[model samples]
Target: MEVDHLFEIGDKIVYPMHGAGVIKAIEEKEIQGKTQQYFIMVFPVRKLQLMLPIAKMDDSGMRLVLNMTAIEKVMDMFRQGEIDRSLTYKQRYKINTDKMKTGKTQDGAEVIRDLMLVKKEKALNSNEKMMLREAMQFLISELELSNSMTEMQAADLLNDRLNVEKDAG
Candidate 1:
């Protein structure tokens, strides 16, 4: 039987709060007496795999990895995105967490930009530090597939851009 698939094998898609992965297979699985088509994907950088029911792809918040032009635009936004220093810790954390849920590369970049700027002023609390790490990983995962960058290359490029403000300061 032909399967109606939102993403086929070899497609790069990002799952919100989970990072990005490449679709590796489509298989039919029986669970709780329900047989359904699922897409299997491997997340290379994070060294993980995921299987999602094809019917629930939209609910899962999966989207195609940013294309070349879009990725470039995101990079520019990352560099230009401003940090609001007046927000209380509670407010900032809430905003950042909401961004992560959006699963947009741009939102992830904004989280990095805001927290990194905060770090430059004062050490991040444990929660902020963890958020920064996860944001960086998520951003890197997308860059790897969307921009054809190695992990090191993506990390270096982000670090380099993050340092632009430091040089000017």
Candidate 2:
């Protein structure tokens, strides 16, 4: 149960199933008679605050946003357009969900690319649509932070790079 202490206040981090957010504070709270450190994170997009136990940082899939060089690589992933659309929707959903849970920039891009391909051929069900939105948001938020781009700029950049629809709503 070793937690990697890599984050500090003001550091931008990404949480799996969540999005990019800033660490607002660090505090210790006693729970069940044991005191532990936590990172207080504020997600502006979601308008949510989270107190993540420091001891569970790695286990929780929290990670620093990619650096600029890494982000460049992620952008390249979008250009390849190598989506595997052969799987059934259920199978694709499961695979995409697993990728999203990894909270990696490239994985998120892959999900967006795959789903956008699916959407172009046919409309997605509500669940798939939601998943596409979330994954795109996750990717965009990280790009915004890591690249110091505005949200609109990031969205436009991604749209141009991936050649996908703009309806990430």
Candidate that would win on lDDT: 1
TM-score of every candidate relative to the true structure: 0.91, 0.86
Per-residue lDDT of candidate 1, residues 1-169 (tens digit): 6876568899999999989889999999998999998899899998999889988987888999988678767767654656687899999999999999999998998898888778878999999999999999998888888888898998887778667755754
- Judged by TM-score, which candidate is best? 1
lDDT of 2 at 41: 95
- Model 2 residue 119 distance off true place after TM-score fit, in angstroms: 1.7
lDDT of 2 by residue, 1-169 (tens): 3445888899999998888889999998888999998899997667789999887887998988888788777766654565565688899999999999998888888888788777878899999999999998887788788888888887777777665433332
- Candidate 1 achieves a global lDDT of 0.86
Clashes of each: 0, 0
Collision count of model 2: 0
lDDT of each prediction vs. the true structure? 0.86, 0.83
